[model samples]
Target: MSVDTIYKVILYPFITESIASLKAMTNLQGTAGDPFIDNVDDFRFKGYAVCSDVTGNLDGVIMMHHYPETAIAIGNSVCEKMFDEKYEHTEITEELSNALAEWGNTIVGRSTDLHGRYSLEYNFSSPYFVHDVSDMAKYLAGVTEVVTVPITVEGVGRYYFNLLVRSVDYQQVGIKREESRGIENTHTTTLETSSKILLVDDSAMIRKALKRYLAQLGYHNVIEADDGASAVTMVASESPDFMFMDVVMGEVNGDEALRQIRAAGSNVPIVMLSSVTDKVLVDKCKDLGISGFIFKPIQADSGAEIIKDYLKIA
Candidate 1:
């Protein structure tokens, strides 16, 4: 059977971006096994899970299930990255819970960005944690199908992304659903479309999504690099007119790469992309002279406006 469009466009992309986000946040390599489909009743929780309710174009539950050790390990990694802490955790703590929750939020939030592009906007409630989940029948009351993808992070162990799919409740979402494109569907731009653009991010899925947005705005001369080091090299070799760089990357981060590019005397209009909201980090990026900022789960309209302003497309 053909996969549902929701899975093909939103859920599947969510799974891919989840792995990318995991690696970006923790500097750990993550790999995904084939996705398994089953009834919601078959949902298995190892020792811990974080779950959030998704609403809007699609409504259902989305979760990340992990063994206790896996949660502790990954949470510690996030702590080290965010706070520069060296202490390791053997049990779940308030700090660790927050880190895992934020991580879950990032994965779901980025997936929703793809929703807007496909005209399937969605919003997710804040995630909550569960220990040794034995029953989810309440949450799965009306849900029928569950798609679980197993993701492993080598020494850190494995976790699963489980999506409980359900049809949207028109009354609850408070809007009539329509198949046709409305006024917001138009993504046309009067700006020149021939600018050679560079997209730098470790996630192939994220690059592909952004490329689609750029294409919709008439930009096609695009090149991609999966990490900051390659981005630095491509900036010299490709000489793109504009660039979009991710903040957290392997090798060199967006800020350091920006410093290198400027040091090389290249004044390309570069916009920084990230989900991080740390003011200090944002200020540091400004100090490095970013052309603009596009928060993660990037909005197409906002990105378009930033590009137009930087390119002076009047």
Candidate 2:
């Protein structure tokens, strides 16, 4: 709830990466530019990264805005750094956008760790590219303060990574985040929990990612079913110990699938995985008897731990 909470979680990562990029491009060990508190005065992005909408209420809705030229540039730069040239941004704006997006995400994770005990969590938005800063600034209606992290990219020029923090008391917000506590056997409990797994998804890409993430965590026995109908079938047949069920699909979606599973007398742990987290959708999920849920782009270790908890792994 404290204003300093945001800084404690995110500031170090943002500042370090931005400064390193500036140093590489400028070949200078000093600061790039003054880390200013921008009043949302016209910003721009250059290379390749596109902004995505994360979550939370900034005007009761959350989104990431990138000034076109600047964003693209940030994107390209970030692409180069995070991956190979194949992922490099074609435009400078994209480079900037990607760089900043990566930066923001990293900071969000860091902040999550810091404020976890306080019950504060950040739901990041997708980085979206826009050429007009004024238009984007309109969305910052409820944002009390935004810190523009200044960095001197070695030779590429001076750019910024922004932390749009809207403060609220940790106790005042109503949101559910998994408990961040763990015992010394954290790593062991994660890998040994190879219980029944249900894969309910219409998209192969998403399913692929989930499967890969799980496999990497050493959960090799997996079951994949495309729609709600098939998901029910899998639940009965596989009797999976746990599942990664998506919310939207062609014939039947997550809600119906979950309802069907419950109706069929299945109590296997199921995590509602989806790209969107709308109130109506969540209500439906709650109605279906699903106690666990995870959003799209699952993070490392989380799925494994959730599965363990649901399956009661030793």
Q: Which candidate number maximizes lDDT? A: 1
TM per model? 0.52, 0.42
Off by over 4 Å in 1: 1-6, 121-123, 131-135, 168-314
**How many clashes (backbone N, Cα, C below 3 Å) per candidate?**
0, 71
lDDT of 2: 0.50
lDDT of 2 at 116: 35
Model 2 agreement with the true structure over 157-214: per-residue lDDT tens digits = 4445565555533234322223222111222233244565777886554465467666
